[model samples]
Each structure stands twice: as structure tokens, then as C-alpha cells.
Target: MKGRSVILGQINGLEAAALMVDGQLEDLLIDSSGFAPLPPGAICRAKLGRQMKGQGGVFVDLPEGQTGFLREGKGLRPGDTVICQVAGGAEPGKALPVSLRVLFKSRYAIVTPGAPGLNISRRIRDEETRDGLQALADMVMEGSDMGLILRSACEGTEDGEIVEDIAAMRDLAEAVMADLDGAPELLVDAPTPHEEAWREWAEPAPDEVIEGDFATHGVLDAIEALASPRVDLPGSGYMMIEPTRALVAVDVNTGNDTSPAAALKANIIAARELPRQLRLRGLGGQITIDFAPMPKRDRQALEQQLRAAIKGETETSLAGWTPLGNFEMQRKRDRVARAMLIGGTE
Candidate 1:
């Protein structure tokens, strides 16, 4: 397999990074300057602000006017201050203050307080693998109150590494708890998206890292191609992606190759490429994919393969096809729209 490349650029004056695999953009990671710098996995002290009626989550007011979402905290009243960890980041007008869950993310595991037990990644379906990780967790987490979630990255991690990671998180948790008396304080900042991306994929080793600036406009222009409505597939066919005020419509065209076999191949390739486009563009919300007419069996098979490719994506889902033969889907809206990012809008 060809190694990936990392491209860095400026989108709306915020630093951004894009990971490209085999000449195609895999994901575009961007950081905006509008929000306070809170790195993921960092615990912080926050106070409950006014409860927004009809909202599923409560607003947590941190120091310096920073806000957070207490998605699952119970018995919280307005003006009540508590400690919260930065679970996710803030987007322009959406996902602000970041979703503040009390979960601490480590390299090999997630330490969640009050849930005292060990849980393995559901992707590790093999009973033997799950049991092995459970044994390892039990050995290292002796007498610890926090529960551990063994991440997929811990599949083959050494015993010492797991031990060290848990130890570091424990110490960090202890320090945060020690200073809980201070209200509206930031105990820790979350890791930047670029840092997390580098730590995860840089070791597989990228061929090059491109930085985007006024001097590197060519790179940004190339990256912007991913946001285009029409894209040609590798061997044959093409895809037209149209976004409206409601849902995103993706129409697949087999082009000159009309044979059933050729169409199937093209649809499969398009199915694989579509998710990459969504990630690179940060396009989310309801999505409709129209495949070139294929047999029902082949369409079902294609859906399976597509779902497997996007399995871990919490926001995106293949909701099956419509009566009119189009595939219906939904992806949670997360980042700023692609047009805004490409145009460098403020």
C-alpha cells in the first residue's frame, strides 16, 4: 500500500492539516481560533450556567467565558461549578465549548471515573483478544476507581506501555481532583487535532508534509478539489455531489462503461470514495447516494461493504435505499461547511 502525505494549510486563518492517501484526501483536520484552546483529554473546572430549557445538555460556564456541554451529568443546577474534561473541540457556530464529558482519553485506553471496570473495544470481537486485554487491565488497574476502555490501538501494545499510560492518567486525575475547590478554572487543555493526527498516523510514515500558506496556495488549491461537486473515479465512471439547504445528493454515473460488471465495479469504487470525500470536506447532515442502476443483490452487497468502510464513524450511517433506488443516509453536522473553508470566510 502507498504511504500517506500530510498537508498543512490555513482555512479562515486557523491552522489546518489534511491527510492524503494515494493521491486522494483522506481527512481534513482544522483548528479555528474563535474558541479557547482546550485540548482533548484535558480535565478542567467548570460551573453550570443557566439551564437552557428543551436542550438535552446543560451549559457549563468555564473561566474566560468558555462554555461546554454536560451531555450526561445528572443533578446539575445553574451556577453549580464542577470539573469537566474536554471531550471534543469547538466549531464555528456549532459544537461550541466542546462536548465536556468526564472521560480521559489515553493512548491505549480511556479512563472514565465512577465506572469502575474494564471494557474492550467492540471492534475486537474475538473473545480471546477481549479476554487478554481484560486480564491486562485487571493487572495494571488494581484498586483504581476509574474504569478503563481498551482502545483499538491497544491490540498489541506491550504490558509496560499500558501500565505507564494508566499510571500517567491516574496521576493527572488525582491532580485535577486535588484542585477542585477553585471554580471556573481550566485544569487541562485538550490536544490539538494536528497533534492527535500526527501521533496516530505519522509513524506509519508519510511521504511528505505540505504546509498551506499564501506561498503554498497551489497545495491548498489541490486540496480544495475534494470539495468539488464532480469527481472522476480511478478506472472508470464519475460522481456528482450536490449539497442543498436540506440534504446532500450524490449521483454516480458509469460514464461510457454501461455493462453491468463495469457499473458494479464503478459503484463499488464510488462507494469507497464517498466517505473520503465527506471527511475531507467535513460535509455532514442528511446524505443521499444514487448509484447507477444495479441488481438488488449487488446493491445489498455494496451497502455492506460501504458500511464496513465507515463502521467507526459515529456521525455517519448508511440508512438504506429509498423506494426510488437512491441510498438514504445521515451524517452528523460537525465542522464548518466546505465552501466556507475553501473560500477562507471569517
Candidate 2:
């Protein structure tokens, strides 16, 4: 997936859940497990784990089992669960850390490293600019217990947008601070939904497109307009793509073929369809494609043809078939393959 998708819930406070495209839950960096209460600024050792439904790693008091989550994109190992002490408590469930003495311990600072063309520090200063920057710093330094990175929105952003974000953070901070003693001790800021972000950032402009029977017409029309001059596959042959933490598999079948050379023809046709399928489905990362088998000679020719077909595509690497007759390939994980396959509808 290109970005994070959020799930909303309430447990004393608002909680946002984020999952990968294939549904592997990420870590949410706030403490949720009830345990010994640590006052704000009290240093205490804790343990942390990456939750499957949020965007960051969660922290917990090691021996107590009370959990806390860290920010997304923080490199966390599945096995390197750590021991951390609370440096301070902010917004109830949120805590700050003092030292990195524990394994897999993430820092409590939010820093957005800048890129060559994307300068994050560059901003438009105005009356609201000063107030917004100060408010953002205050929220990061006080409200959230973990580090915060100013999103790309900070790049080339106007004072008004900055002020708006600052205002949102301020409101969230106020709510969190106010509910520290109430039934909602932990307050969660609503997470921005993926669909809204995708609509704003990655909506494509295509010339012509095709939609499957399962797809909505409005979505299909939008995709068709973006992928103009494209054609859809005919007949009953279908492909199923499944992505897992281990690997991605693409299965191609000859749904309605009735020819004597059905196997060979299906293999060839599937091979021909492979390139388009990969592109249309946005299949990436480590990929394995299995097609109905053909004769040895035809298999060799088909492999060569398929390889040639996808030679110029970006960020795609292909390898010849193995003795077991499956094609092995690699694609960079960036976009959602499922969305592409469904023509960006689902």
C-alpha cells in the first residue's frame, strides 16, 4: 500500500488502527494495557511490540503487561522486543522515553528527514505561521509522547494550512489533556482515512479503462477515463492474486477453454496476459506466478516471450522459470496491487 489506512475505536479514548494493504496490522504507539500508573516525567522500564492493526510499535511496562505503541515507519524487529522506562506521560496513555537502553526501543522525538527535492523546512511565513509553528512544536513536545514528523504537507505549505494543522493538533491536545481523569483517560485524534488521502494524492488520470463485473460503475468509469484506450480481457479466464507477509502469488486459470491445445494455449495466453495483469494490478515486491503448464518447448518459448514483454517496465525484475515450472519475479512494494486489479475502486 502507498499509505496507511486507519480503523477507529473507543476504549477510554479514541484509538486509530492502521494495516498494510494485505492486512498485516501495524503498531499503535500508545499504552492501552492497564497497569501500574506512572506519573508524567517518571522514568520507568517498559517493553514494546508492533501491533498488527496500527501504524507504529506499542510500548508496555515489561513485567506488568501494560502496552504502549510507537510511531509508524520506525524500524522495529519482530523479535527485538525491548525494555523501556517512561520518561513522561502525556495525553494519558501516551508516554515519553528517556534513554535507548532497551532493544527495539524507539525514540520519543518526531523528525521528518528531508529529501533532495522535498525540502521540509522550507515554509511560507506570515502572521499565522509563527503561531502555527509554535503550536506544532508545543504539541509534539508535550501532547504526544512519541516523536512526530511533519508530513509532506509541510513542504511548500501556506500559513493557513499550517495553522489549520496546528489548530487540529491543538484541539486534539486539549481534548487529551482535559480527559486525563475522566472515563476517557486516553484520547486519540481521529486518523485520516486512506480513501480520502488516495483521492487527494494518487487519483490517476487515465485515457480508457475496463472494470470487472464485481466493480462499481462509477469507480469503473473514473478508471476508464484515466486508462483510456485500454482493453479488458474477454472470456472466463480469471486471475487471483494473494499477498502475504511471506510472498505474493498470482494464479492464472483457463476458465472456459475448450480447445485440444488448451493447456499450451492457455499458458501462452496467460503469459501474454501476465504483463498487463502485473501493470493493471500493480503487483510488486516478491511475486510468483503460476500458469497452467504447457509442453517443455512451449514453456521455454513462453518464458522468453513473457520476459521480453515486461522488459521496460519500471521497478520490475523477472527471472526464468524454475524446474517446478513457476515464474519467479520481484516488484518494489509501493502501491496497492489489489486496487489496481480492481481498477482503483476497492
Candidate 3:
């Protein structure tokens, strides 16, 4: 109960994975069926479709009459075949988001086919360690044309595993790249929930791993709670998260607290916990936060806390305070909304 644990289990008949740290649910990933035909990270051989006028983008043919939108179509004409990776799920009836850049990502290494270079994560800054990793990369990637990047998770991973990971990804990349004449089909299927957990949660390795029986560990109940919008905060504060057609709205409130610093305290709590809430719920897009009434001078403090909260996030951008005293930010659509998992929303 005091260390990190990964639960690969089924919740309400759906495959799900949860990362629990110190008995608290830190992260969750669920394989949502009907989210899309090709889930994120799926690779396919697709033929370019008609281009969107004034949009600077084109659609690609997917299996079963499905199509994907690719934003980087310059110099490429319709009917041209190109290998693409599924970027993320589409919004309802829209085309699936896709990208021309394909990457074979594992826990230790990410094999890059387009970019050619051997790079180490900046987190590994020690000169001696960096030198050792460089040598390792050179040895493992001998005669390889594709690029290789050692992830931060590689810092404490075993050398043999690191080597195997790099080699495996490189081999997979080679195989994927070699097939060029196939009909539009899936080359690589998206990773499963448990597989994704292993690939992502390998570093800082969990203290324990539990397989199945998610209900035994309260994961099922947690999922139901996550589907709700009212998240209770410290000092009797709470925030309601609602997703709409255009954006996510966060409204903070200090519940029955008479303290003079109630407004600021509620806002501070909201700022710190917002990212975690969004992450567990898989809610992303344009987000606007309406903090409880506070002084204009408090904006700087709230912004500071918010920036610190998102420092570790890669796909979110802090767009700063709005003219109407609201705060806004943008995030990538990485996964299906948690509410959809429980059939709370369409």
C-alpha cells in the first residue's frame, strides 16, 4: 500500500489498467471499444484521398470505408500511397487524426525512421553515464539507418533489457518499413491496456504487479467516481468538470468554508489538482478554468501554481489568463473521455 503498484484488470467488462501509488490511483488507461477503428499508435499503409480545400490537409483511405486526416500532405498528390500512424481518436463522425511520421516506441528506446540520429534523454546528464549510454547505442544500432533515442526510463533499466528493447524496436521498424506494396491495411495494431502499461510504466518500476480482479482493489469504484464531474478538494473545496462540444469547463467552489482565504485556497487546490484530474479522466482540448472570486493580484500566484503543475506534461500548453479573469489552456486529445467508458456521455 506504500509503493507503486500496477493493476491489469477488467472493469465492468472492459479491459483497463491502473497505476496506483501509495494506495492512490495516480494514472489509468482503458481500452475503449468503438473509440475508433484504429486506436492511437496504429500503423497502416494508406492511399491518399482528396485534399480539403483551404484546409492544407488531405484524407487517407482506411480499411472498411474509414478515412483518416493527415495534416502534412505537401508535395504529395492524391492516390499516392504512404505509411501513416494513427494520431488519436476522431471526434464522433470526423476523420481519424493521423500523421505521416511513424515511430516504433518501446519502454527503453524509440526507433525513428525519418530522423537519423542517436540521442539520449536530457534527464541523463551525467557525463560518465551519458558516455556509457552512447557506447551502448552505438553497439546496438550498428549498421542501422533509422534513428534511436534512449528514453529517460533507460536511466536505471538493466543493460540487457535496454539492448533487447532497442534491437526489438529496430527490427520491428525495419519490418514495418519493408512492406510497401500492400493494400491499405493495418501494419501494427495498437497496444493493449496491459501491454501499454508495461511499455510505459516500466521505469521507476512498480513495487508490485497484480493481474486481474480490479474490483478487489477498488479500481472499479474509482472508475465510477472518475466518471463524475464533482471532484472534492482540500478544505471542503470542489470543482465541477464538464466537457462540451468546443471546450472543457472547470468551475471551482469553496464549499461552506467561512475562512477569509477560502477563495484563494480553493483556487490553489484546483490549480494543483487539475492536471491529475484531467489525466485520469482522459479529458483534453481547450480548457477554461473559472476560479472562485479573488483579487486580480492573485492571478500571478494562480498562474505560477498552474505552470508548476504542468511542467512535466508534454502535450499541454498553458495559454495564460483570459481577459475576463478566466484561465485557459490547450491539450491534445490523447484518449477517450472517461465518462464514455461508463456510458455517461455519447
Number of the top candidate by TM-score? 3
Of the candidates numbered 1 and 3, which has the greater TM-score value?
3
Candidate 2, superposed: residue stretches over 4 Å from native: 1-218, 221-233, 336-346
Residue runs of model 1 more than 4 Å from their true location after superposition: 4-23, 34-44, 49-55, 59-75, 82-100, 119-136, 151-161, 177-185, 202-222, 242-247, 256-266, 292-299, 322-325, 332-346
Q: What is the lDDT of residue 225 in candidate 1?
A: 71
Against the true structure, candidate 2 reaches a TM-score of 0.35
Instruction: List, residue by residue over 1-346, the lDDT tens digit for candidate 3.
Output: 6799999987667687899988788899888756667877889989999999899899999764678999999999999888889876656777887888898999889999988999998988888888888999999999988999998888867788888989899999999888778679899988888889998887778999999787787766667778778999977999999999789999999999978899999999999999988988888889999999999988899889998998776489989888898999998777777776655311
**lDDT of each model, Cα atoms only?**
0.70, 0.41, 0.86
- State how far residue 166 of model 1 sits from its true place (Å): 2.1
**lDDT of model 1 at residue 37?**
50
Ranking by lDDT: 3, 1, 2
Candidate 2 residue-wise lDDT, 140-168, digit = tens: 44633433334434534465655455445
Candidate 1 C-alpha lDDT tens digits along 1-346:
1457776666667677777677545776666334445544556788787666677778887665667777755677787767776654444444343443467766677777767778887767778878888888887778877788887776666877877887787777667765767668777765565665664554346787766562343446556575568989987699998877678889998888867588788888998888877766667778998898888889878998788777656467778988999998887655545565466332
Task: Sort the predicted structures by TM-score, highest score first.
Answer: 3, 1, 2
Report each candidate's C-alpha RMSD, comma-separated, in the order given: 4.9, 14.1, 2.3
**Stronger candidate by lDDT (2 vs 3):** 3
- What C-alpha lDDT does candidate 2 achieve relative to the native structure? 0.41
After superposition, candidate 3 runs with Cα above 4 Å error? 344-346
